[model samples]
Target: MLDKRRNSNSKERIDLINRFIGLFGKQVIQSVAADREFVGKNRLAFLNRNEIRYYIRIRNNFKVFLPQKNKEIKASHLFNCFKTNQFVYYNKIVRINEQLCYLSGCKLNSKNIKQDFLIIVSFNKPENAQEEYQKRWQIEMYFKAMKSSVFDIEKTYLQDIQRIEKLILLVMIAFILCYKIGIYLHQINPITIKKHGRKAEVFLNMG
Candidate 1:
Protein backbone atom coordinates (compact mmCIF):
# COMPACT_ATOMS: atom_id res chain seq x y z
CA MET A 1 0.00 0.00 0.00
CA LEU A 2 1.23 3.51 -0.76
CA ASP A 3 1.26 5.79 2.27
CA LYS A 4 2.04 9.48 2.46
CA ARG A 5 1.70 10.58 6.07
CA ARG A 6 -1.09 7.99 6.43
CA ASN A 7 -2.98 9.22 3.39
CA SER A 8 -2.59 8.26 -0.27
CA ASN A 9 -2.40 10.87 -3.01
CA SER A 10 -4.28 10.65 -6.29
CA LYS A 11 -1.16 9.62 -8.22
CA GLU A 12 -0.36 6.92 -5.68
CA ARG A 13 -3.87 5.56 -5.92
CA ILE A 14 -3.71 5.53 -9.73
CA ASP A 15 -0.31 3.85 -9.66
CA LEU A 16 -1.69 1.18 -7.37
CA ILE A 17 -4.48 0.51 -9.84
CA ASN A 18 -1.98 0.40 -12.70
CA ARG A 19 0.25 -1.92 -10.68
CA PHE A 20 -2.62 -4.28 -10.12
CA ILE A 21 -3.32 -4.37 -13.85
CA GLY A 22 0.37 -4.88 -14.63
CA LEU A 23 0.63 -7.76 -12.15
CA PHE A 24 -2.65 -9.42 -13.06
CA GLY A 25 -2.93 -8.30 -16.72
CA LYS A 26 -5.90 -6.45 -18.23
CA GLN A 27 -8.25 -9.43 -18.39
CA VAL A 28 -7.95 -10.04 -14.67
CA ILE A 29 -8.59 -6.36 -13.87
CA GLN A 30 -12.25 -6.83 -14.72
CA SER A 31 -13.59 -4.32 -12.25
CA VAL A 32 -12.41 -2.15 -9.38
CA ALA A 33 -14.66 -0.94 -6.60
CA ALA A 34 -14.04 1.83 -4.08
CA ASP A 35 -15.80 4.39 -1.92
CA ARG A 36 -16.01 8.14 -2.52
CA GLU A 37 -12.39 8.59 -1.47
CA PHE A 38 -11.36 7.15 -4.85
CA VAL A 39 -13.81 9.18 -6.86
CA GLY A 40 -12.33 11.83 -9.13
CA LYS A 41 -12.56 12.98 -12.73
CA ASN A 42 -9.13 11.67 -13.68
CA ARG A 43 -9.58 8.33 -11.92
CA LEU A 44 -12.96 7.72 -13.53
CA ALA A 45 -11.67 8.76 -16.93
CA PHE A 46 -8.62 6.52 -16.58
CA LEU A 47 -10.77 3.52 -15.79
CA ASN A 48 -13.15 4.31 -18.63
CA ARG A 49 -10.36 4.82 -21.16
CA ASN A 50 -8.75 1.55 -20.14
CA GLU A 51 -12.15 -0.20 -20.36
CA ILE A 52 -11.98 -1.27 -16.73
CA ARG A 53 -15.37 -1.51 -15.08
CA TYR A 54 -15.62 0.42 -11.83
CA TYR A 55 -18.34 0.69 -9.21
CA ILE A 56 -17.30 3.71 -7.17
CA ARG A 57 -19.57 5.25 -4.58
CA ILE A 58 -20.37 8.94 -4.95
CA ARG A 59 -21.28 11.43 -2.30
CA ASN A 60 -24.82 12.74 -2.21
CA ASN A 61 -23.63 16.23 -3.00
CA PHE A 62 -21.83 15.29 -6.23
CA LYS A 63 -23.48 16.70 -9.34
CA VAL A 64 -24.54 14.34 -12.12
CA PHE A 65 -25.58 15.12 -15.70
CA LEU A 66 -28.51 13.22 -17.12
CA PRO A 67 -27.90 12.64 -20.81
CA GLN A 68 -31.35 11.36 -21.59
CA LYS A 69 -33.30 14.12 -19.93
CA ASN A 70 -30.69 16.72 -20.86
CA LYS A 71 -30.41 18.05 -17.34
CA GLU A 72 -28.05 18.07 -14.38
CA ILE A 73 -29.05 16.45 -11.09
CA LYS A 74 -27.48 16.37 -7.69
CA ALA A 75 -26.87 12.88 -6.34
CA SER A 76 -28.93 13.71 -3.26
CA HIS A 77 -31.97 14.67 -5.34
CA LEU A 78 -31.98 11.24 -6.97
CA PHE A 79 -32.96 9.61 -3.67
CA ASN A 80 -36.04 11.73 -2.94
CA CYS A 81 -38.42 9.22 -4.54
CA PHE A 82 -36.83 6.03 -3.19
CA LYS A 83 -38.00 3.95 -0.23
CA THR A 84 -35.92 1.89 2.14
CA ASN A 85 -34.11 -0.97 0.44
CA GLN A 86 -35.36 0.50 -2.81
CA PHE A 87 -32.95 0.91 -5.72
CA VAL A 88 -33.31 3.51 -8.47
CA TYR A 89 -31.23 3.21 -11.59
CA TYR A 90 -30.42 5.63 -14.38
CA ASN A 91 -29.18 3.32 -17.12
CA LYS A 92 -28.91 6.07 -19.70
CA ILE A 93 -25.35 7.28 -20.04
CA VAL A 94 -24.53 10.15 -17.69
CA ARG A 95 -21.65 12.56 -18.01
CA ILE A 96 -19.05 13.45 -15.44
CA ASN A 97 -16.72 15.69 -17.40
CA GLU A 98 -16.28 14.00 -20.79
CA GLN A 99 -16.39 10.55 -19.17
CA LEU A 100 -19.70 8.64 -19.32
CA CYS A 101 -21.10 6.50 -16.50
CA TYR A 102 -24.20 4.74 -15.22
CA LEU A 103 -25.76 6.18 -12.08
CA SER A 104 -27.61 4.25 -9.38
CA GLY A 105 -29.13 5.38 -6.11
CA CYS A 106 -30.39 3.28 -3.27
CA LYS A 107 -32.25 4.17 -0.08
CA LEU A 108 -30.92 1.59 2.31
CA ASN A 109 -32.32 0.52 5.71
CA SER A 110 -35.20 3.02 5.51
CA LYS A 111 -37.52 1.56 8.12
CA ASN A 112 -36.39 4.03 10.78
CA ILE A 113 -36.33 7.02 8.36
CA LYS A 114 -32.61 7.09 8.83
CA GLN A 115 -30.76 8.92 6.08
CA ASP A 116 -28.86 5.94 4.73
CA PHE A 117 -28.34 6.34 0.99
CA LEU A 118 -25.86 5.21 -1.65
CA ILE A 119 -24.84 6.63 -5.01
CA ILE A 120 -22.91 4.42 -7.40
CA VAL A 121 -21.36 5.62 -10.66
CA SER A 122 -20.17 2.87 -12.90
CA PHE A 123 -19.10 1.88 -16.39
CA ASN A 124 -22.17 0.37 -18.04
CA LYS A 125 -24.88 -1.09 -15.85
CA PRO A 126 -22.86 -3.52 -13.79
CA GLU A 127 -24.94 -6.46 -12.66
CA ASN A 128 -26.01 -6.46 -9.01
CA ALA A 129 -24.34 -3.07 -8.44
CA GLN A 130 -25.82 -2.72 -4.97
CA GLU A 131 -24.53 -6.14 -3.99
CA GLU A 132 -21.12 -5.23 -5.36
CA TYR A 133 -21.10 -1.93 -3.45
CA GLN A 134 -21.85 -3.79 -0.21
CA LYS A 135 -18.58 -5.68 -0.62
CA ARG A 136 -16.71 -2.52 0.45
CA TRP A 137 -17.69 -3.29 4.04
CA GLN A 138 -15.72 -6.54 3.88
CA ILE A 139 -12.51 -4.55 3.38
CA GLU A 140 -13.57 -2.26 6.23
CA MET A 141 -14.01 -5.29 8.49
CA TYR A 142 -10.50 -6.45 7.58
CA PHE A 143 -9.09 -3.12 8.78
CA LYS A 144 -11.24 -3.29 11.91
CA ALA A 145 -9.87 -6.73 12.70
CA MET A 146 -6.31 -5.57 12.07
CA LYS A 147 -6.66 -2.49 14.26
CA SER A 148 -8.77 -3.60 17.20
CA SER A 149 -10.75 -6.82 17.13
CA VAL A 150 -8.00 -9.39 16.76
CA PHE A 151 -4.52 -7.92 16.16
CA ASP A 152 -4.86 -4.60 18.01
CA ILE A 153 -2.20 -2.99 15.87
CA GLU A 154 -3.41 0.51 16.68
CA LYS A 155 -2.13 0.32 20.26
CA THR A 156 1.47 -0.16 19.16
CA TYR A 157 3.90 2.64 19.99
CA LEU A 158 6.45 2.09 17.26
CA GLN A 159 8.31 5.27 16.34
CA ASP A 160 9.65 4.34 12.90
CA ILE A 161 6.99 4.53 10.21
CA GLN A 162 8.64 1.77 8.21
CA ARG A 163 8.70 -0.51 11.22
CA ILE A 164 5.07 0.23 11.96
CA GLU A 165 4.19 -0.62 8.38
CA LYS A 166 6.04 -3.92 8.60
CA LEU A 167 4.41 -4.71 11.93
CA ILE A 168 1.05 -4.03 10.42
CA LEU A 169 1.91 -6.36 7.56
CA LEU A 170 2.69 -9.11 10.02
CA VAL A 171 -0.58 -8.41 11.77
CA MET A 172 -2.31 -8.63 8.41
CA ILE A 173 -0.89 -12.10 7.92
CA ALA A 174 -2.09 -13.07 11.38
CA PHE A 175 -5.54 -11.65 10.60
CA ILE A 176 -5.72 -13.75 7.46
CA LEU A 177 -4.83 -16.87 9.44
CA CYS A 178 -7.45 -16.03 12.04
CA TYR A 179 -10.03 -15.42 9.33
CA LYS A 180 -9.32 -18.81 7.82
CA ILE A 181 -9.68 -20.44 11.21
CA GLY A 182 -12.92 -18.56 11.80
CA ILE A 183 -14.34 -19.71 8.48
CA TYR A 184 -13.27 -23.31 9.11
CA LEU A 185 -14.94 -23.36 12.49
CA HIS A 186 -17.99 -21.72 10.99
CA GLN A 187 -18.27 -24.50 8.45
CA ILE A 188 -17.93 -27.18 11.11
CA ASN A 189 -20.78 -25.99 13.32
CA PRO A 190 -22.64 -23.19 11.43
CA ILE A 191 -24.10 -21.44 14.46
CA THR A 192 -25.70 -18.16 13.38
CA ILE A 193 -26.89 -15.31 15.58
CA LYS A 194 -29.18 -13.39 13.24
CA LYS A 195 -31.80 -14.89 10.95
CA HIS A 196 -31.82 -12.13 8.31
CA GLY A 197 -30.15 -12.39 4.92
CA ARG A 198 -27.29 -10.00 5.73
CA LYS A 199 -26.39 -11.47 9.11
CA ALA A 200 -27.14 -15.09 8.30
CA GLU A 201 -23.52 -15.92 7.44
CA VAL A 202 -22.01 -14.02 10.37
CA PHE A 203 -20.34 -16.60 12.60
CA LEU A 204 -19.30 -15.97 16.19
CA ASN A 205 -15.60 -15.25 16.70
CA MET A 206 -13.78 -18.57 16.86
CA GLY A 207 -11.01 -17.07 18.97
Candidate 2:
Protein backbone atom coordinates (compact mmCIF):
# COMPACT_ATOMS: atom_id res chain seq x y z
CA MET A 1 0.00 0.00 0.00
CA LEU A 2 2.86 2.39 0.84
CA ASP A 3 4.63 1.57 -2.44
CA LYS A 4 1.46 2.25 -4.42
CA ARG A 5 0.98 5.61 -2.69
CA ARG A 6 4.60 6.62 -3.45
CA ASN A 7 4.15 5.71 -7.13
CA SER A 8 0.93 7.75 -7.32
CA ASN A 9 2.64 10.80 -5.79
CA SER A 10 5.59 10.42 -8.20
CA LYS A 11 3.26 10.30 -11.19
CA GLU A 12 1.36 13.37 -9.97
CA ARG A 13 4.60 15.36 -9.58
CA ILE A 14 5.78 14.31 -13.05
CA ASP A 15 2.45 15.37 -14.58
CA LEU A 16 2.72 18.78 -12.93
CA ILE A 17 6.28 19.20 -14.27
CA ASN A 18 5.25 18.17 -17.76
CA ARG A 19 2.38 20.72 -17.76
CA PHE A 20 4.92 23.46 -16.91
CA ILE A 21 7.33 22.20 -19.57
CA GLY A 22 4.60 22.36 -22.21
CA LEU A 23 3.67 25.97 -21.31
CA PHE A 24 7.24 27.26 -21.06
CA GLY A 25 9.94 25.38 -22.97
CA LYS A 26 12.21 23.09 -20.90
CA GLN A 27 14.90 25.79 -20.44
CA VAL A 28 12.45 28.30 -18.96
CA ILE A 29 10.29 25.79 -17.08
CA GLN A 30 12.63 25.37 -14.14
CA SER A 31 13.07 29.12 -13.75
CA VAL A 32 9.31 29.73 -14.01
CA ALA A 33 8.46 27.03 -11.50
CA ALA A 34 11.09 28.20 -8.99
CA ASP A 35 9.91 31.81 -9.29
CA ARG A 36 7.14 32.06 -6.66
CA GLU A 37 6.17 35.52 -7.94
CA PHE A 38 5.02 34.10 -11.29
CA VAL A 39 3.16 31.12 -9.79
CA GLY A 40 1.26 33.31 -7.29
CA LYS A 41 -0.12 35.64 -9.99
CA ASN A 42 -3.29 34.81 -12.03
CA ARG A 43 -2.92 32.07 -14.66
CA LEU A 44 -3.92 34.49 -17.45
CA ALA A 45 -0.92 36.68 -16.55
CA PHE A 46 1.32 33.62 -16.44
CA LEU A 47 0.33 32.85 -20.07
CA ASN A 48 2.64 35.71 -21.04
CA ARG A 49 5.59 33.59 -19.90
CA ASN A 50 4.78 31.11 -22.70
CA GLU A 51 5.76 33.82 -25.21
CA ILE A 52 9.22 35.17 -25.97
CA ARG A 53 9.77 38.94 -25.91
CA TYR A 54 10.66 39.36 -29.61
CA TYR A 55 7.59 37.35 -30.70
CA ILE A 56 4.91 39.22 -28.68
CA ARG A 57 1.94 41.18 -30.10
CA ILE A 58 -1.53 42.27 -28.92
CA ARG A 59 -4.91 42.45 -30.66
CA ASN A 60 -7.07 45.56 -31.29
CA ASN A 61 -9.63 44.20 -28.81
CA PHE A 62 -7.04 45.01 -26.13
CA LYS A 63 -6.90 48.77 -26.96
CA VAL A 64 -9.68 49.93 -24.62
CA PHE A 65 -8.04 48.32 -21.59
CA LEU A 66 -4.70 49.80 -22.71
CA PRO A 67 -5.70 53.49 -22.25
CA GLN A 68 -7.04 52.76 -18.78
CA LYS A 69 -3.65 51.34 -17.78
CA ASN A 70 -0.55 53.09 -19.10
CA LYS A 71 0.06 54.98 -22.39
CA GLU A 72 3.73 53.97 -22.84
CA ILE A 73 3.08 50.26 -22.40
CA LYS A 74 3.59 48.36 -25.67
CA ALA A 75 1.70 45.37 -27.08
CA SER A 76 4.54 43.28 -25.70
CA HIS A 77 2.96 43.83 -22.27
CA LEU A 78 0.25 41.33 -23.15
CA PHE A 79 2.93 38.66 -23.26
CA ASN A 80 5.12 40.26 -20.58
CA CYS A 81 2.67 40.19 -17.71
CA PHE A 82 5.36 40.40 -15.05
CA LYS A 83 6.48 43.78 -16.37
CA THR A 84 2.91 44.94 -16.88
CA ASN A 85 1.82 44.06 -13.34
CA GLN A 86 4.97 45.20 -11.55
CA PHE A 87 5.41 48.62 -13.18
CA VAL A 88 1.78 49.24 -14.20
CA TYR A 89 3.17 49.45 -17.74
CA TYR A 90 0.57 48.84 -20.43
CA ASN A 91 1.23 50.18 -24.00
CA LYS A 92 4.53 50.37 -25.79
CA ILE A 93 4.58 52.14 -29.21
CA VAL A 94 6.50 50.03 -31.73
CA ARG A 95 7.44 50.79 -35.34
CA ILE A 96 6.14 48.22 -37.78
CA ASN A 97 8.81 46.97 -40.14
CA GLU A 98 7.80 48.07 -43.67
CA GLN A 99 9.84 45.23 -45.21
CA LEU A 100 8.12 42.67 -42.99
CA CYS A 101 4.70 44.18 -43.60
CA TYR A 102 1.17 43.46 -42.44
CA LEU A 103 -2.19 44.60 -43.81
CA SER A 104 -2.48 48.37 -43.27
CA GLY A 105 -6.24 48.65 -43.50
CA CYS A 106 -9.03 46.94 -41.57
CA LYS A 107 -12.82 47.38 -41.83
CA LEU A 108 -14.15 48.85 -38.59
CA ASN A 109 -17.74 48.50 -37.35
CA SER A 110 -19.27 51.98 -36.90
CA LYS A 111 -21.18 51.00 -33.78
CA ASN A 112 -18.26 49.29 -32.06
CA ILE A 113 -15.16 51.31 -31.17
CA LYS A 114 -13.32 48.08 -30.27
CA GLN A 115 -13.51 46.74 -33.84
CA ASP A 116 -11.64 49.74 -35.25
CA PHE A 117 -8.21 48.91 -33.84
CA LEU A 118 -6.50 45.71 -34.96
CA ILE A 119 -3.07 44.78 -33.59
CA ILE A 120 -0.86 42.19 -35.24
CA VAL A 121 1.60 40.21 -33.14
CA SER A 122 4.51 38.77 -35.12
CA PHE A 123 6.76 36.10 -33.63
CA ASN A 124 10.47 35.67 -34.22
CA LYS A 125 9.95 31.91 -33.96
CA PRO A 126 7.07 31.70 -36.43
CA GLU A 127 8.17 28.25 -37.68
CA ASN A 128 7.73 26.78 -34.18
CA ALA A 129 4.18 28.14 -33.86
CA GLN A 130 3.34 27.36 -37.54
CA GLU A 131 3.89 23.59 -37.14
CA GLU A 132 1.83 23.51 -33.92
CA TYR A 133 -1.01 25.53 -35.54
CA GLN A 134 -0.91 23.25 -38.63
CA LYS A 135 -1.57 20.23 -36.39
CA ARG A 136 -4.87 21.90 -35.36
CA TRP A 137 -5.77 22.32 -39.07
CA GLN A 138 -5.05 18.62 -39.72
CA ILE A 139 -7.35 17.65 -36.81
CA GLU A 140 -10.12 19.94 -38.18
CA MET A 141 -9.69 18.39 -41.65
CA TYR A 142 -10.03 14.86 -40.24
CA PHE A 143 -13.20 15.84 -38.35
CA LYS A 144 -14.63 17.47 -41.49
CA ALA A 145 -13.90 14.38 -43.62
CA MET A 146 -15.36 12.09 -40.96
CA LYS A 147 -18.56 14.12 -40.66
CA SER A 148 -19.18 14.97 -44.32
CA SER A 149 -17.52 12.27 -46.45
CA VAL A 150 -17.44 9.05 -44.45
CA PHE A 151 -20.39 9.64 -42.12
CA ASP A 152 -22.81 11.43 -44.49
CA ILE A 153 -23.77 13.23 -41.27
CA GLU A 154 -25.96 15.78 -43.05
CA LYS A 155 -28.11 13.10 -44.72
CA THR A 156 -29.83 12.28 -41.41
CA TYR A 157 -33.36 11.42 -42.55
CA LEU A 158 -34.02 9.80 -39.15
CA GLN A 159 -35.99 11.93 -36.70
CA ASP A 160 -36.19 9.29 -33.92
CA ILE A 161 -33.45 8.86 -31.28
CA GLN A 162 -32.99 5.11 -31.88
CA ARG A 163 -32.66 5.65 -35.65
CA ILE A 164 -30.12 8.43 -35.00
CA GLU A 165 -28.02 5.98 -32.95
CA LYS A 166 -28.03 3.54 -35.91
CA LEU A 167 -26.90 6.31 -38.25
CA ILE A 168 -24.04 7.16 -35.87
CA LEU A 169 -22.90 3.50 -35.83
CA LEU A 170 -22.95 3.38 -39.64
CA VAL A 171 -20.88 6.56 -39.80
CA MET A 172 -18.33 5.21 -37.32
CA ILE A 173 -17.93 2.00 -39.34
CA ALA A 174 -17.40 4.00 -42.54
CA PHE A 175 -14.76 6.16 -40.87
CA ILE A 176 -12.89 3.08 -39.58
CA LEU A 177 -12.97 1.47 -43.03
CA CYS A 178 -11.54 4.61 -44.67
CA TYR A 179 -8.83 4.94 -41.98
CA LYS A 180 -7.73 1.29 -42.38
CA ILE A 181 -7.58 1.55 -46.19
CA GLY A 182 -5.49 4.74 -45.93
CA ILE A 183 -3.05 3.04 -43.53
CA TYR A 184 -2.71 -0.02 -45.79
CA LEU A 185 -2.06 2.09 -48.92
CA HIS A 186 0.53 4.16 -47.06
CA GLN A 187 2.41 0.94 -46.10
CA ILE A 188 2.78 -0.29 -49.76
CA ASN A 189 6.28 -0.01 -51.29
CA PRO A 190 6.98 1.49 -54.74
CA ILE A 191 10.06 -0.79 -55.07
CA THR A 192 7.84 -3.93 -54.78
CA ILE A 193 5.60 -2.59 -57.57
CA LYS A 194 8.65 -1.89 -59.79
CA LYS A 195 10.05 -5.43 -59.18
CA HIS A 196 6.70 -7.00 -60.10
CA GLY A 197 6.58 -4.91 -63.31
CA ARG A 198 10.09 -6.11 -64.26
CA LYS A 199 9.15 -9.81 -63.65
CA ALA A 200 6.04 -9.37 -65.80
CA GLU A 201 8.17 -7.83 -68.61
CA VAL A 202 10.61 -10.78 -68.47
CA PHE A 203 7.71 -13.28 -68.56
CA LEU A 204 6.25 -11.52 -71.63
CA ASN A 205 9.66 -11.58 -73.37
CA MET A 206 10.00 -15.34 -72.72
CA GLY A 207 6.45 -15.98 -73.93
Candidate 3:
Protein backbone atom coordinates (compact mmCIF):
# COMPACT_ATOMS: atom_id res chain seq x y z
CA MET A 1 0.00 0.00 0.00
CA LEU A 2 1.20 3.54 -0.65
CA ASP A 3 1.78 5.42 2.59
CA LYS A 4 2.61 9.06 3.32
CA ARG A 5 2.92 10.90 6.63
CA ARG A 6 -0.73 11.77 6.10
CA ASN A 7 -3.05 10.41 3.40
CA SER A 8 -1.26 9.22 0.27
CA ASN A 9 -1.68 11.52 -2.70
CA SER A 10 -4.07 10.69 -5.55
CA LYS A 11 -1.21 9.99 -7.98
CA GLU A 12 0.20 7.31 -5.69
CA ARG A 13 -3.23 5.73 -5.24
CA ILE A 14 -3.80 5.70 -9.00
CA ASP A 15 -0.31 4.26 -9.61
CA LEU A 16 -0.97 1.47 -7.13
CA ILE A 17 -4.28 0.72 -8.81
CA ASN A 18 -2.49 0.67 -12.19
CA ARG A 19 0.12 -1.74 -10.87
CA PHE A 20 -2.52 -4.21 -9.66
CA ILE A 21 -4.68 -3.91 -12.78
CA GLY A 22 -1.58 -4.46 -14.90
CA LEU A 23 -0.59 -7.50 -12.85
CA PHE A 24 -4.00 -9.19 -13.03
CA GLY A 25 -5.09 -7.77 -16.38
CA LYS A 26 -8.52 -6.11 -16.39
CA GLN A 27 -10.38 -9.17 -17.72
CA VAL A 28 -9.60 -11.34 -14.68
CA ILE A 29 -10.85 -8.77 -12.19
CA GLN A 30 -14.60 -8.56 -11.85
CA SER A 31 -14.87 -5.22 -10.02
CA VAL A 32 -13.21 -3.13 -7.35
CA ALA A 33 -15.05 -1.97 -4.24
CA ALA A 34 -13.98 0.49 -1.58
CA ASP A 35 -15.28 2.92 1.03
CA ARG A 36 -15.35 6.71 0.72
CA GLU A 37 -11.61 6.92 1.22
CA PHE A 38 -11.08 5.68 -2.34
CA VAL A 39 -14.02 7.61 -3.79
CA GLY A 40 -12.53 10.70 -5.42
CA LYS A 41 -12.97 12.43 -8.75
CA ASN A 42 -9.69 11.34 -10.38
CA ARG A 43 -9.82 7.75 -9.10
CA LEU A 44 -13.46 7.22 -10.06
CA ALA A 45 -12.82 8.73 -13.49
CA PHE A 46 -9.78 6.51 -13.99
CA LEU A 47 -11.77 3.38 -13.14
CA ASN A 48 -14.69 4.37 -15.36
CA ARG A 49 -12.40 5.34 -18.25
CA ASN A 50 -10.63 1.99 -17.99
CA GLU A 51 -14.05 0.27 -18.03
CA ILE A 52 -13.50 -1.17 -14.57
CA ARG A 53 -16.66 -1.52 -12.51
CA TYR A 54 -16.51 -0.06 -9.03
CA TYR A 55 -18.82 0.00 -6.01
CA ILE A 56 -17.76 2.69 -3.59
CA ARG A 57 -19.62 4.19 -0.68
CA ILE A 58 -20.02 7.95 -0.42
CA ARG A 59 -20.94 10.32 2.38
CA ASN A 60 -24.60 11.24 2.78
CA ASN A 61 -23.90 14.93 2.39
CA PHE A 62 -21.73 14.47 -0.72
CA LYS A 63 -22.98 16.50 -3.68
CA VAL A 64 -23.98 14.99 -7.01
CA PHE A 65 -25.60 16.18 -10.20
CA LEU A 66 -28.79 14.62 -11.50
CA PRO A 67 -28.40 14.42 -15.26
CA GLN A 68 -32.07 13.64 -15.85
CA LYS A 69 -33.48 16.25 -13.45
CA ASN A 70 -30.73 18.68 -14.42
CA LYS A 71 -29.79 19.85 -10.97
CA GLU A 72 -26.99 19.35 -8.42
CA ILE A 73 -27.98 18.20 -4.93
CA LYS A 74 -26.65 16.49 -1.83
CA ALA A 75 -26.52 12.71 -2.15
CA SER A 76 -29.05 12.17 0.65
CA HIS A 77 -31.50 14.63 -0.86
CA LEU A 78 -31.98 12.20 -3.73
CA PHE A 79 -33.73 9.89 -1.29
CA ASN A 80 -35.94 12.53 0.29
CA CYS A 81 -39.04 10.38 -0.26
CA PHE A 82 -37.49 7.18 1.05
CA LYS A 83 -38.39 5.87 4.48
CA THR A 84 -36.55 3.49 6.78
CA ASN A 85 -35.63 0.11 5.22
CA GLN A 86 -36.61 1.51 1.83
CA PHE A 87 -33.92 1.68 -0.84
CA VAL A 88 -33.64 4.34 -3.50
CA TYR A 89 -31.56 3.74 -6.59
CA TYR A 90 -30.90 6.09 -9.45
CA ASN A 91 -30.23 3.35 -11.99
CA LYS A 92 -29.61 5.68 -14.93
CA ILE A 93 -26.80 7.86 -13.61
CA VAL A 94 -25.77 10.37 -10.95
CA ARG A 95 -22.86 12.69 -11.51
CA ILE A 96 -20.35 12.85 -8.69
CA ASN A 97 -17.33 15.08 -9.12
CA GLU A 98 -18.21 15.16 -12.83
CA GLN A 99 -17.99 11.36 -13.14
CA LEU A 100 -21.27 9.67 -13.98
CA CYS A 101 -22.19 6.97 -11.47
CA TYR A 102 -25.19 4.88 -10.39
CA LEU A 103 -26.39 5.76 -6.93
CA SER A 104 -28.17 3.57 -4.38
CA GLY A 105 -28.90 4.10 -0.71
CA CYS A 106 -31.17 3.37 2.25
CA LYS A 107 -31.87 4.87 5.62
CA LEU A 108 -30.83 2.70 8.54
CA ASN A 109 -33.44 0.89 10.61
CA SER A 110 -33.03 3.16 13.61
CA LYS A 111 -34.59 6.26 15.12
CA ASN A 112 -31.49 8.36 14.45
CA ILE A 113 -32.27 8.79 10.76
CA LYS A 114 -29.89 11.66 10.11
CA GLN A 115 -27.01 9.86 11.76
CA ASP A 116 -27.59 6.56 9.92
CA PHE A 117 -27.64 6.08 6.19
CA LEU A 118 -25.64 4.30 3.49
CA ILE A 119 -25.08 5.87 0.10
CA ILE A 120 -23.12 4.05 -2.60
CA VAL A 121 -21.94 5.14 -6.00
CA SER A 122 -21.21 2.51 -8.60
CA PHE A 123 -20.50 1.78 -12.26
CA ASN A 124 -22.76 -1.28 -12.71
CA LYS A 125 -25.52 -3.41 -11.20
CA PRO A 126 -27.16 -0.79 -9.02
CA GLU A 127 -29.48 -3.45 -7.61
CA ASN A 128 -26.54 -5.43 -6.23
CA ALA A 129 -24.28 -2.56 -5.23
CA GLN A 130 -24.85 -2.97 -1.49
CA GLU A 131 -24.29 -6.71 -1.68
CA GLU A 132 -21.11 -6.14 -3.68
CA TYR A 133 -20.00 -3.65 -1.05
CA GLN A 134 -20.21 -6.44 1.55
CA LYS A 135 -17.09 -8.02 0.01
CA ARG A 136 -15.04 -5.25 1.60
CA TRP A 137 -15.66 -6.88 4.98
CA GLN A 138 -13.12 -9.59 4.16
CA ILE A 139 -10.44 -6.97 3.62
CA GLU A 140 -11.45 -5.22 6.84
CA MET A 141 -11.27 -8.46 8.78
CA TYR A 142 -7.83 -9.19 7.32
CA PHE A 143 -6.60 -5.78 8.43
CA LYS A 144 -8.01 -6.31 11.92
CA ALA A 145 -6.35 -9.71 12.15
CA MET A 146 -3.03 -8.29 11.04
CA LYS A 147 -3.20 -5.38 13.47
CA SER A 148 -4.66 -6.88 16.64
CA SER A 149 -6.62 -10.12 16.47
CA VAL A 150 -3.74 -12.27 15.34
CA PHE A 151 -0.38 -10.70 14.41
CA ASP A 152 -0.64 -7.44 16.36
CA ILE A 153 1.55 -5.81 13.70
CA GLU A 154 0.56 -2.29 14.77
CA LYS A 155 2.36 -2.72 18.07
CA THR A 156 5.69 -2.81 16.25
CA TYR A 157 4.91 0.55 14.60
CA LEU A 158 7.27 0.24 11.67
CA GLN A 159 7.69 3.69 10.09
CA ASP A 160 9.77 2.76 7.06
CA ILE A 161 7.67 1.65 4.09
CA GLN A 162 9.99 -1.23 3.20
CA ARG A 163 9.98 -2.61 6.73
CA ILE A 164 6.22 -2.26 7.07
CA GLU A 165 5.66 -4.02 3.76
CA LYS A 166 8.00 -6.84 4.73
CA LEU A 167 6.26 -7.37 8.05
CA ILE A 168 2.88 -7.27 6.33
CA LEU A 169 4.05 -9.80 3.77
CA LEU A 170 5.10 -12.22 6.51
CA VAL A 171 1.88 -11.76 8.47
CA MET A 172 -0.10 -11.97 5.24
CA ILE A 173 1.40 -15.38 4.54
CA ALA A 174 0.39 -16.63 7.96
CA PHE A 175 -3.04 -15.13 7.59
CA ILE A 176 -3.51 -16.94 4.31
CA LEU A 177 -2.52 -20.22 5.91
CA CYS A 178 -5.01 -19.72 8.69
CA TYR A 179 -7.64 -18.68 6.18
CA LYS A 180 -7.19 -21.94 4.30
CA ILE A 181 -7.59 -23.93 7.47
CA GLY A 182 -10.66 -21.94 8.38
CA ILE A 183 -12.18 -22.72 5.01
CA TYR A 184 -11.44 -26.39 5.37
CA LEU A 185 -13.06 -26.52 8.77
CA HIS A 186 -16.02 -24.52 7.57
CA GLN A 187 -16.69 -27.01 4.81
CA ILE A 188 -16.74 -29.88 7.27
CA ASN A 189 -18.95 -28.16 9.85
CA PRO A 190 -20.38 -25.02 8.22
CA ILE A 191 -20.76 -21.74 10.05
CA THR A 192 -24.07 -21.13 11.75
CA ILE A 193 -25.89 -17.96 10.90
CA LYS A 194 -27.97 -16.07 13.45
CA LYS A 195 -31.31 -14.42 12.73
CA HIS A 196 -29.52 -11.37 11.38
CA GLY A 197 -27.52 -13.27 8.73
CA ARG A 198 -24.33 -13.05 10.70
CA LYS A 199 -22.17 -15.48 12.59
CA ALA A 200 -21.39 -14.71 16.24
CA GLU A 201 -17.73 -15.14 15.44
CA VAL A 202 -15.77 -14.80 12.23
CA PHE A 203 -16.41 -18.01 10.28
CA LEU A 204 -12.94 -17.59 8.88
CA ASN A 205 -10.32 -16.36 11.28
CA MET A 206 -6.76 -16.87 12.61
CA GLY A 207 -7.52 -20.29 14.00
TM-score for each model: 0.85, 0.31, 0.88
What lDDT does model 2 reach?
A: 0.37
When summed lDDT is taken over every stretch of 10 residues in candidate 3, the lowest stretch is 198-207
Candidate 1 accuracy as lDDT? 0.77
As for model 1, its CA RMSD to the true structure in angstroms is 2.9
* TM-score, prediction 3: 0.88
**Residues 43-87, model 1: lDDT tens digits:** 888888888888899887788888778898787677768776678
Highest lDDT: which candidate? 3
lDDT of 1 at 74: 81
Model with the higher lDDT, candidate 2 or 3: 3
Residue 24 local lDDT, model 1: 81
Measure candidate 3: CA RMSD: 2.4
Q: Is candidate 1 or 3 superior in lDDT?
A: 3
- Can you write out model 3's per-residue Cα lDDT over 1-207, one digit (the tens) per residue? 565467876678788878887898778877788888778888888988998888899988999998888998888877766887687687678789989889998877767635567888988788988788889989998888887677778788678889888888988898898899888888998888899999866833333
